[model samples]
Target: MTAPGGNMPRREALPAEPNPHAQQLAEQLRALKDHGELSMRQLAARTGYSQKSWERYLGGSSLPPRAAVAALARIRGADPVRLLALHEVAAGTWNNSRTSTPAPAPSPSPAEAPESAASPESAASPESAASPESAESDVLVASGTSAAGAGIGPAAGRSLRIALGAGAVALVLAVSSTVLLALRLDAHEDGPAVASPVPAAVTTSAPAPVYTCRIQRVDGLWYAGISRTPDAEVAYGSTGPGVAEAQCLLRRAGISPGGIDGMFGPLTQRAVKALQKRSGLVPDGMVGPLTWKALRG
Candidate 1:
């Protein structure tokens, strides 16, 4: 809901029933402080107004000059329209105070001005027409603050109300932009992660079995060589399933089993022992029950 002084039309009832303008002015002050990231003291310092004065203005205990309103807008980097509207309110209140009398009959609505009147100044510096004092007054009239006061007359109040309504809409948009930006950042930071699918298990159980014939006698025992040819060896260096399984297990564990040249060679023997140790089995190179269970698993 709009405050009495603000442009917004949905006027909210405040506990400060005697002066609806006071509540809206308070909101304007809060919006400035929030948007500008300024403390009351800091705003006072920037505008050359004392902190006490700022407090009183913001606290709704007293009204300030149109110049002060413009100074506040400049300090906050806010649009001058708001400040100007506030200035008008202050001026209206001041003018009314001189008479110390009730408000006169309402006046007719003012004619619409060029769009340029609504646009921000093009120059880097504020124009003389848009000076702090002028702009502050403009803000007051624009926000319906002056309308609420006695001096501006009844017709001016309606125009000021409309203008303040428009200004309030602009303010809402400005504030929402910041809120939207924050929401976007929060979404990016806490967004969910897409997970990869786990691989399917191979259906085939029995591995293509390796053939095992006793090798030619080497010095005395079967020493993992050809049976009759003596020169010929197995398909690979492997002696039997036991050694091959050990090699396969080692490969699965990210260790090299020397190209699966599966002779029960030194490399194979070491790999078997390593697997045995990893599986909490006795560290013998032999594929006994414990070692076999580990390799199979």
Candidate 2:
């Protein structure tokens, strides 16, 4: 039966037994979506997959590709390996089912039957004709052998002389070619050598130096420094070298803090909030010890 909205019924309610592995994977994906508080549309926006595709996946109507599974797991911070294993099992089961399906038996072509049945009939004619032809061939061969034994005929002697003359001509042509090749080689050796043009070397730009983030206590306060230490709170509207360090760290964590001008702004706040959410902390748009630890970690 069709669903109330006229959509196809969900696979879960189907009569045929559902694939256990596919059902399990769909359950895990549903739980992950709940944990991330993400709707199908939101997931599509984040993962570039269509919302309807995700619906089919969650509804257990179809198996998702491995890449889709990986992308979902990455967004939800779930274990991709486990999900992929389930996908593999489901994919294998699908493949086996398709392979096990019985195919229609092949029918013999009309031309094949006629050709097979006519083979013996055709072969008998050739066999009957072969006997007389072979006898004639044998008589001819006996006559030729007797003629050859009774001293070479005039035609045979003429053929031998022609063969000898052709051999001599061939030998002469070969010797002439060899002499010409040697002469050419000697002339090439005597000539002055010509140098080939060399290609210019290609130069490439060097890679930028890597910035290592560190936390250190300086004087009487903490400062977040690049390749140094961290001992400061970088909140909205904060400005200093510490703020710059925080921005750098956020950028390193794949978050974009608007600028690295040592000024904390809304962009930086949003990045911090994202990090906080991922780190399972309260996202108050504040960069405290926990936020710093999450960033550094």
Candidate 3:
């Protein structure tokens, strides 16, 4: 089947750290679409969103907006409140993950800087050598004064240590966040789950009934006739041979009517509506003359 928009590029692959909440919501959306037996285009038509948008949402390539989620839930007869809650959670998580601060670059230590511009060779020149004793006395006095000034008070030293510890803690947190993001991505990649196909029939102890109808054309119109009239309207909740005939025609048109038990249920109605929409007729969930003709093809 063609994607909703013509010749659009495929969506990018899902990120490594896909938001778990978003993945859950996407899975639920897929399940609902499968239950409804809807194609992307059909879903788009019903939900007023593009088929491409639905594809991205269902594929987990992007988190759908709240309005889109609600629309899809309504179409699939699901609980909008629950789905929207999931959306909100996923949206918040995704946003937070995206907004994490980048780790700071490591700063150079004080020892890495140059101590002084003067070299030992320049200091040991003849003129300096002549006053070596005086120079040595001056150096001793400066060293003693420097040592006294460099001695930090106990309280100041303790505060400095506390500040350093806090910086270390902050650095650790930043590193941990990065690692966690990576692990989340890895987990998501490892557990790729595809949605299971929708069951053709609901579980029941009783065997399902089979239906058959004869197709014929008369007066340039086609019909799947099980009755003398051959043009009877079959709608939801309608039963008997005519319903069976409509179901048969629907099956022939490549649309499933849930099962051919001769009962017009929701599945049958949806099939009729889909066929009507495809044939450019009013999709009122009723199998009228135009729908019958289209299905008979």
Candidate 4:
């Protein structure tokens, strides 16, 4: 689902107020002057003013004129409201000094001014880049100092450049990883879409059934009988003429005939017994001439 802002989603509302110290007004002006390598007198002349007046304002001795403030603000690219506040402070201090009457001379202390702040060298120059916040100070100095002292002055620019490079590399890696992950997810989501069924191609062909005959002995041989009782069947010594044909015929009647070789083995006898049982004849394994002739007939 999407919001009603056409194809674009509506953004959340932002806080109405902006920060008062967004540009750190005083700091920016100082940095700009330092970076431009200009003295207050030179800056004033560039914008049109006397050196003494420039000193009074920059030295924190007197409030700056509105024209001078506007000029400095323009050069520094700072908000006028914050710069105006600094002017007010300088004016108030100047007023207090002029109003105080000389009373007592009892307070002639040596520590009235900071030793570092009062020194001629310090008065003519600035502090070392190590004081205050090292990172911010280094940034200011790097942007202001020449290539020689850029160890402190050029630190901020270098760090920012390095940070931007690292961010670009990280963004590229993130985009590549996201694309690869999406491709893998899509492959999984649309798992194997092609399928085919196997076809049955079985071929079956049966052979013609063959028949064989048999006759043999178990303990003692008996006559192969038409009756189911083996005890009632008669015995015979030799198979008569046409016995080979009769054996082949008996083989067809589901009896083993020992390969139709005119003699019977135990295999033939066992087959005869199995046949007797199936035909309701005697199970005693035997085959006489009568049974043979009957099988042939």
lDDT of each: 0.53, 0.63, 0.64, 0.45
Worst 10 residues of 2 by lDDT: 194-203
Best by lDDT: 3
Flag the better candidate by TM-score, 1 or 3. 3
The parts of candidate 4 lying over 4 Å away from their true place are 1-29, 102-297
**Against the true structure, what is each candidate's TM-score?**
0.28, 0.30, 0.30, 0.24
1-297 per-residue lDDT for model 4 (tens digits): 222321111222222212223223334445556666666546644655444444444433334444456566777666767666755564444334433433221222567346533656435433222211223323433444433344532434433433443344346446856997999999877765432122222223443333233343334442232222322233223343233444455566766656654444555566666666766666666655444434433
Position 73, candidate 2: lDDT: 92
Please give the distance, in angstroms, between residue 270's alpha carbon in candidate 1 and its true position after superposition. Answer: 85
Ranking by lDDT: 3, 2, 1, 4
Which pairs clash inside model 2?
215-229, 215-230, 216-229, 216-230, 222-231, 223-231
Candidate 2 lDDT, tens digit per residue, 160-209?
43344334434644685699799999888866543222222223445434
Give the higher-TM-score candidate: 1 or 2. 2
User: Worst ten-residue run, lDDT, model 1?
Assistant: 226-235
As for candidate 3, its clashing pairs are 16-185
Candidate 1: what lDDT? 0.53
Candidate 1 wrongly placed segments (more than 4 Å): 1-17, 93-297
Alpha-carbon shift of residue 172 in model 4 (angstroms):
56
For candidate 3, write residues 148-223 as lDDT tens digits: 4688443343334334433443464468569979999987877644222234234434675555666676676545
Q: Candidate 4 — what's its lDDT?
A: 0.45
